[model samples]
Target: MSMENAIFLQKNVGFCNALKRICIEGFEYSTLYKRIEKMIADEEKKEEKNEKLLVDLWECNLLLSYQLDSKMLSICVPCLLKFALKKEEDEETPKEVEMALLSLSNIKFYRAEKELYLNEIKEIIRNHQEHHNLTRLAYQSAWQFLMNRSLVYRDLKGIVMNELHFAREVGKELEEFAKCVDWKKEKEEEMGKETKEKLVLMRWFHVLFIFFGLCNLWNEEFIGLVGGIAWVLRAAKENHKKISEKYIYLLGNAAKRRDVKVEGLLKIGVVDSVLEEIQQSTLNEGVTFQSCHFFLKISERLKEKTDNDELEEGNRKATKMEIFEKLEEEGYDDTITSYHEFLHLLKVNKIDFDAISLDISEYFVNV
Candidate 1:
């Protein structure tokens, strides 16, 4: 049916009621599928096109796909990806591309369909990696694709962390995310007012890196994140505590790896930021423990380097001493002591263990 007719039917009570009755009487969705196929074939002709039809068809597909599971969506995948990857033909992005990506993200895919189209989906994301209009939707689509598969395949988790180059992506996103925050701005202004898209991207980074840490995928390259991670942690600490804690837990997981150097993390300002988090008036035991766990891991790595022949003797001692002195100056000594005391309290039943809700270690092993 033409979109005009569809709109008319939607607006007319009698026509809508009649259509509903027919649908209830087991009208085959194949009719809609045939109409969609014809539209796509016509779209492929590359003649003058009805932009409204393209957008409406995609939006209609998305809405209907949600309300009723339809295999016809699989047929639309290639056309959707093509439209989503279309070059900018005008000043504004073609509305169909965004609609295509949004539709792709919402469609439920079986494992077989994902395997069939996964590489194409990944290519679509890479093609638009820098596109202002499409980048977020591209990743959102890919994220949804992998997320659905990861539920059953398990190994796709490693694919997202290892093969996806999320570290590089995070670097780019953080560079953009930094522009949204102004240190000179008042604390209240900076607290929770970050753009929703950037905030969502931050959470994505947290999850991606958590997998990165758990999978032991942090190479020297990824270990070099300087201010970005710490900025994300501190920026989210006040109003977005859940993500802040996730980042802390991610840092703990990363620190647990022997290859992740303490100095790099120190350069990232995580040490100071974590210490600041520990000293927050609203202390969270889980965050404190994870913070201490990070310190413990770094201290152990430093101690090992100090005791072993990994570094030249004098330099090793100096570096370890310098870091330790800095930690002491930051009151890390008191924080560690407090963390130990808190653990003791939990052990002795003085502090309720139930209050410590986030079990970060599980994320490490499960992934």
Candidate 2:
């Protein structure tokens, strides 16, 4: 058989094999996982194949009797996205991928307490350590955690069950790789030692997490919110930092394309002020306009605290009728839309709004 045909048949065979092993009569994680990977790779191999592959993958997702390892596809999706971003020539697609990954950036599950998903594949690693067999079950567990909201495993305690039935199959090969390394030579090799130390230092924080996590490790669920937030924030911050002037211009252009708010802001004499504020904020020493959203979230509170005296008229709660009538007379569309877009862009861009020049975007735009 041709290699291509062989691969196709292999996928079907693997899927059927997986199906037979599933607790559910026809649940098959391997088949779905391979199918998804094949579809993506096939789409990459030939442009003509893109639509067909998308349809195939969608159908595979739908027809699968259960999610099975499809949940693993959630984690796998970002990996594919990363590869796509690197390989694809299209500009528009990366932004869509970015948004999709951001939305799926979270995986929350209840273990003993709760587990907030991070980039660490610790579960996989831990599985390898306990079970000699890295069977489909382990993969399914990881997959379920990623895709299924972990409802099945919810409220479970993670008492590292004794030696897994098949730990030798997976970890054995990995262990062989470790043995291949010459520890004496590796230690004597300055560059190798330095690199190892660097990696250790880099991952020190994760070590801290596992250490501290021991307290609630046996809890019904595990929520790694702090770790997850740190991972996400770091990723967003890194990606935003990679933005060039051209990229920002594109962003601003996109904002301009969202024209309803900009035009309305101008009509209300706030457009120039808001833009100027954003510009000044962006130019502030070591400041990013992305930070603007952070300030925006609490801007009203800050205004109340620090700018209270600025309101010489004194503070008084206006009746709904008064507030609405005033807003209507001034046209709330422009002000509301402009501010929302402004702050949203700021947050999306990961700017430190708190550190930027205050309200500069809102300043001259209003004039």
The top-ranked prediction according to lDDT is 1
User: Which 10 successive residues of model 1 have the least lDDT summed?
Assistant: 14-23
Worst 10 residues of 2 by lDDT: 218-227
TM-score of each: 0.61, 0.23
Off by over 4 Å in 2: 1-125, 128-228, 235-367
The models' CA-based lDDT, in order, is: 0.56, 0.34
Task: Supply candidate 2's per-residue lDDT for 314.
Answer: 36
lDDT of 2 at 111: 30
Per-residue lDDT value at 320 in model 2: 24
Which tens-of-lDDT digit does each residue in 1-367 have in candidate 2? Answer: 8645654564444344332322233444467456665666666578465543353343333234344343545434444333323333465544333322222222232232223342333444354455433332323233223333324442221322122212222223323423443444545665333332222222222222232322232111112222222222222222222212222222232222211122222233332222333333234322234323322322332233324554432321222234335344544435544666776798899998566665443422222
